[model samples]
Target: MWKRLLGFDPATMKVRTEILAGITTFLTMSYILAVNPAILSLTGMDKGAVFTATAVSSIIATLIMALWAKLPFALAPGMGLNAFFAFTVCLGMGNSWEFALTAVLIEGILFILLTLSNLREAIVNAIPMSLKNAIGAGIGLFIAFIGLQNAGIITSNDSTLVSLGNITSSSPLLALIGIVIVSVLLIRKVKGALLIGILVTTLIGIPMGVTNYRGILDWPPSVAPTFFKFDFSGIFTPQMGLTVFTLLFLDMFDTIGTLVGVSTRAGMMKDGKIPNAKQAFMADAVGTTLGAMLGTSTVSTYVESSSGVAQGGRSGMTALTVAAGFIIALLFSPLFLSIPGAATCPVLVLVGLFMLSPIKDIDLDDYSESIPSFICIITIPMAYSISDGIVLGLISYVLINLLCGKRKKLTLPMYIMALLFTLKYIL
Candidate 1:
């Protein structure tokens, strides 16, 4: 596995290189295992159960990536999907945790069906290339915004716009320090720069009394595992099914965008098709369903998995290494919990920056592409929802195309996407 991932004969690689790659992959994805449970815990689910669900789902998803996708990519509960699970499905919809889990399960199953039926491909092909680039940039902006908000460097104002925070505040200052330091390191082409920046910022935060140290000193208490709590009772209802379907589709597109961005970076596309996309989608579907059964939200491939690729990961071995680390961390949740948000926030912000590099190449001459592209790219962080960005982007794309005398460029699937966006707006 090490040989496959590192492109070196396992018999010949320096032990240090192998260890370093493994550690890199682990650190890049460890946040998912920790964050998923923490986010779900907000829904008032049993903390112990949520943790167990996170571990189990991670294990299952990692196994799928290793065995099926066979790519250097780690899958986990997605950041956008978790927010949707928390803010949209659970809180906004006023749904019970069990109901939400049921929705996740149903969505997973539907996702599997969509992949098998070629619907996933249809949807992928339907999206304009420019829109895809915008989606990538938009997600990056969204993630960066999340980091800023978490660091108290940005705050909402009257639900219309977000404004900068008080720079005098310690948290914002620490976050600024982190951002500047990490950005500098990245510009210098430093390897493991993000991790270093995060550690440095976290250490600085500790001295400034911005981060709590109680969790570090107190040994983590072991919590018993509660697995397989599938609750399908409320999921079959019409309203419930629709909600689940919406969540599923939302996660599916989010995953699609990530896969496209990562695969493009890794040269994984052949004739605009990602090899084993079906299998990868299946893995995601199964992982999400399994996550729901285990008592967490939907699990999917993470965009941060691209960080491993950027660090020279070239095969499924990287994902396997990440998965192995997740499994070990599952047994030591307390250790992961000790890493405060301030520490991880820098990494997230840096990853967002790395992901935004593709924006430089997007063609802005064509209004059909450029307008929707700009809207999508800008709306993600501003709207605070990827799905909303996508929906609005697609709608704008169709409108722009019609107005630009390019209605002939509309394919069947594009029409369908536009219709779906319109219906979504109506509903």
Candidate 2:
């Protein structure tokens, strides 16, 4: 049973390799179980409720990936979507968490329809191969930016866009230590190096005063579980529906991009058909809807799981392993809380670097691909938003294709997307 679940053939790799891949995937992506709750807490949601939602959603999504998609990947609440949940939906819109959840459900429905209609394929094909590389690299830069900010290694300056924090400070020092350790291990070709760096950083931080600083370790006596408490009163309302649409659209492309790139790397694609693409998208849509109902942000695929695939994880067992780890972490929230931001920063930054490796394969001679590729790579971290970067890239790609007398390549749907992104920026 284990062999079947792990996609292992007795005729192939040893059991040790499969087990190691599972463990590697779990450790690299485990930060989501805690990070999602931390980000959601900023939206004034109940901490315990958010934690519960994150765990449940991750488990459900991973199970879908394992059983339905049967892919060597894992799913969790996405980073950009969480920021939107906090900064845009909750704070900027001044809406209740219930209203935010309603938006998620609506968007999930749209995602399902888009997938079933096969529109996702057209959208994916419209993007030049170079832009896809840029999207991957841009997301990497975005993740790295988040890591730096969370670790207090980057800060806003009065006159400039941003400035570096003092490395002499405790958080920055610990983050630097973690980064150096992880980089060294990676250079040494060590498997599970990122996880090792995180664990070591956490252990070292105890004496260096990171755990006590956040007051997160000082837990209250007994927090009860908050499960199945979905509030859908504000759904379908005009304003909330629009917001949900934005979130859903953003998440759809992000998931699609990651799925395409990772699936290609995993050898899951043949003749441009990603096997189970429709089912995978449906699972993601359902995961997001369920996540909102459970009181968390949008749930999607984790790109970091590619690192595990690189380590020879060819089956769904790796995803199951990741899901099991999330369940374990949910039960021990206090232990996770004790891990400081510095400990996890290294893993994210390292993963970001890994994602950028595809840039070397892109053909820069094609103007249609080159211009959008440049925009996509630079604008992500520069604009501090993945959606914004993608929007700009897509719009530029269409315009460039038209200019190069390759207007024949421009589909009606592509033009519509270009117009929509233009309106998004204008509005």
Candidate 3:
């Protein structure tokens, strides 16, 4: 049943390989279980509730990807989307978490509708190859930046935009150790290197008085504080509408870009098209919808899924293993959540490097393409938002082509999108 469902032969991908692949994938991305609650708690949400929601949502969504999409991808409350929910909407704009969740719900439904109409695929095809590659590299830098910040290796400076943190600090020192350990294991070609890196760094932290033991088998937090807590009434307001659009726009491109890059690497793309594209797209859409209802941020396909694929995961069996890991995580919340950001920083940075490896394939000699791509690569981290980088790239790509007398290069949809993006700022 497993082989027939996943379309893989035992000779090509054995059960052990798939299980290891699944374990690697889960370990690579499991940091989300801790990170989501930390960010969301800034918005005054219950940390315990967010932790439970994150785990449950990821388990269900990843199961969908394994069963329906039959792809070795894991779903979770996305990092950037969670940051936007906490920092931008709740704290910056002073809106309630309920209002932010409503925006996410709306975004997910809109995505499902667009996917059903086949419009999402059209948008995917519309992006130029150069721009798509740039988006991936840009997101790579964004991920690395997140790791540095999380580990306290990068901190805000009053004079400069960012500056090095005190290397002697506990967090920075631990992060350095983690990175070195992971890098060495990766050089040795260790299976589950990323997972082992996280675990070893965590153990190392214990002696430094960082990884405190809270005892195991504690009861998981109830989702009551966040479950079905969205404020639908806020959706009609102007500020809330913008919030919804922002969430929708960001998730749209991020998910598509991740799917494209990871699939291309896994040899899952043929002739620039993905097999079972609709199923993959729907898996992401359904995950986001369920995540919001379960009191988490947008659930999307994780780029860390690439780590699993690299471990020779080619079927749903790998993803099913990841789902099982998430189910187990619920019982060991204290253990999982106890992992400090410093211990996992290396994995995030290394994953960033993987995401960026495709930039070598871009045609950098063409100034028009290179310039716009550079804008995308730099702006994502600078602006601290992927959607901002994408819009800027689109606008610049159109304007640069027009000025260079290359107006015929872009399609009508590109021009329309540029205009729409421009009007978003004006109106």
Q: Estimate the lDDT of model 2.
A: 0.74
Off by over 4 Å in 1: 1-35, 42-44, 83-94, 214-226, 265-267
- What candidate 3 gets wrong by more than 4 Å, as runs, is 7-14, 41-44, 91-94, 265-267
Per-residue C-alpha lDDT of model 2 across residues 272-372, encoded as one tens digit per residue: 55666766776787788788777778888877776666567777777777777777666665665667778877877877777677677667786677778
> Stretches of candidate 2 above 4 Å error?
1-35, 38-44, 211-236, 261-275, 306-314
What RMSD, rounded to one decimal, does every model reach? 3.5, 3.5, 2.5
**All candidates: TM-score:** 0.86, 0.86, 0.90
State the weakest 10-residue window (summed lDDT) of model 3: 264-273
Tens digits of per-residue lDDT, candidate 3, 125-207, equal 77777777787788778777888888899999999989999978888899999999989998999877877888899899988
List of clashing residue pairs for candidate 2: none
lDDT of each: 0.72, 0.74, 0.83
Candidate 1 per-residue C-alpha lDDT over 290-321 given as tens digits, one digit per residue, 9 for 90 to 100: 78777778888777666566565655666667
Q: Residue 13 lDDT in model 2?
A: 53
